[model samples]
Target: HPWVGDHPLSPKSVIRDMYERALTFTELVSHYELARTEGIVLRYLASAYKALDHTVPDDLKSEDLQDLIEWLGEMVRQVDSSLLDEWEQLANPEEMTAEEAQEKADQVRPVTANARAFRVLVRNAMFRRVELAALDQVDELGEMDADAGWDADAWGEAMDGYWDEYDDLGTGPDARGPKLLIIEEEPQNALWRVRQIFDDPNDDHDWGISAEVDLTASDAEGRAVVRVTD
Candidate 1:
């Protein structure tokens, strides 16, 4: 199929279509295949962007290619940074012959492109709020009081038990605390745990907590909105 569908094949449309295709492939492919595919896609995207650069109206060109330009610039920066790091390591000569260093460098050098594309894909997915429910939370059980004589194993066991009971109790809104919308999912669990501690009536510890928790969410334009209540 043509990169751009029935729509007039303008430079902007072509670039946008290719980007969409690249993101789709990124999600579908394995890591090894992704690396090769990313290289090809990056080259295609670069060419498309170059074409757009010349053909786009002077008024709209900058705005049209802004994000794409940023991504390409970031890619170059990452590649350059990786090359510098490899060169510095080679200069240090850590018990390796010239051949070994070259081989190591070669293995690592191709990582930047794939890594960049994957990062872009993740960033875009997160911005678009894709599969928000599928994103895993990073549960942070705060450090236990050492004076209580709880060792690491004991603390772990206690946490496991707590979570087990928590799960058994249906993990409903009351049990899990109020739902708060955050930009990313990982921080949501940690924030929920903190809110629970803040709201616990049985807890005697003075946390100097606020009466209301301020949650954050993104607007349709991807702008941050604070003071969001459950």
Candidate 2:
């Protein structure tokens, strides 16, 4: 799409706004990707440990995690082989020539390695959680009381106040948690906004572009637009 006039809402300006919104959406989706990766790592850990005849440590046994794993296992077992094959073909695209397939595989190899590294980090964190729980049990000290002059409520209020101020500074849980919640609550609505600008035919706004371009098409077009305008 070309910007032909001096209009404020030119094609370039509209594309920029769409790009920013899409970028924000992708950032939100990345948080869910991390969660999915964690679930995959957990499943791998459970399966590997079982295969090795290792007992699941009591401290490491989360009921929710176990339930998720069992549900995933059942889902996998119930998947139709034909449907699985069709999904694999759709995802991998067997129509590619040998060279194209190899190039694609080469591109994916680094991503596979990166995912493996992330899985290792997640596994280590899981082990660390168990270790921390064990240490907390070993070092168990009873709660503070009036005899010790440590008012539990007052201490809690002070800590809460500190954390509340920290959160106000945007360095606490509220920073990401609320954003994720907002995006996740109605993800289809967020997606619909993007589609409305770029794909919807009856929309008022026009970006002066052909509809149904690939998601990554913006990168090359954006670079071209910048180079020409600069």
Candidate 3:
């Protein structure tokens, strides 16, 4: 009688409902895609970095590297070049001319305290002999640091093995080949296509494509064909 008075729903029903609420990988992938389209991924990554106590570089404006350069200019103005070298030498305790030491320190100082701390992390990787893809781990570190309970000791404990393992594996991410996606729209039509030749992501050199079309033909209804290619 007492148990019946306290609740109306059965425990089995509650458990089943809770299990149904869990997200599947497909649902998660769909959510991530939507978030990516809405720029939610950028915001999430930025927030994650902030939570980790990791310094985001001032220059990273939504993942752009130009912001880092702009901030570097501003941050460098107040810096006494001579003092920077001293700090660097102090950090490494290496013997060198004040000027030389300052140069080294100055080069590295602009990397501190900004939203793209991950880039600095990549640079740090070079010294430790870590692969470039390990840079991707920044996302995880950022999320951990962003947590309110994170502290220096926790950071050390969490990152120590991560850093060590990366140092031992000196490979980078797989090469992302070239690919292009083109999207075009007309008054009455839409077009999308993927062209293989121009899609190589690693190709720094550019090549032009030739197009032959009759200009005199009337494209009635302005039915333009838009093409999207990846």
Q: Candidate 2: where are CA atoms >4 Å away?
A: 1-95, 108-127, 132-230
What are the clashing pairs of model 1?
none
**Model 1 over residues 1-230: C-alpha lDDT tens digits?**
34223333344654454343333434323422445445544445455544544556668855325555544433332333343334445557776777766665555333223433433433333222211111212121112123324344544554454444332222223222222212332334322111222212333322111111112222121211122121
RMSD of each: 16.4, 24.2, 23.6
1 against 2, candidate with superior TM-score: 1
Q: Lowest summed lDDT over 10 consecutive residues: which window, candidate 3?
A: 221-230
lDDT of the candidates, in the order given:
0.34, 0.28, 0.30
TM-score of predicted structure 3: 0.17
Clashing pairs in 2: none
Query: Which predicted model would earn the best lDDT?
Result: 1
lDDT of prediction 1: 0.34
Write down the TM-score of every candidate.
0.27, 0.18, 0.17
Better of 1 and 3 by TM-score: 1
lDDT of 3 by residue, 1-230 (tens): 34333334333343222222222222333643442232332233223323322355444444333433333232222233333345446656768766776565565333222423322222222212111223435443333333433334543454465445344322222221212212121323222122212211334313211111111121221111111110
Predictions ranked by TM-score, top down?
Answer: 1, 2, 3
- Model 2 over residues 1-230: C-alpha lDDT tens digits? 13212222332343223222222212322533433343343344334324322356656756433533332222222222232233334556767655664454344122112322222222222222222222332121112122323244533443344344332222122221212111111223211011111111233222211112121222222211000000
Whose TM-score is greatest here?
A: 1
Error of 3 at 95 (Å): 54
How high is the lDDT of residue 228 in model 1? 14
Model 1 lowest lDDT segment of ten = 129-138
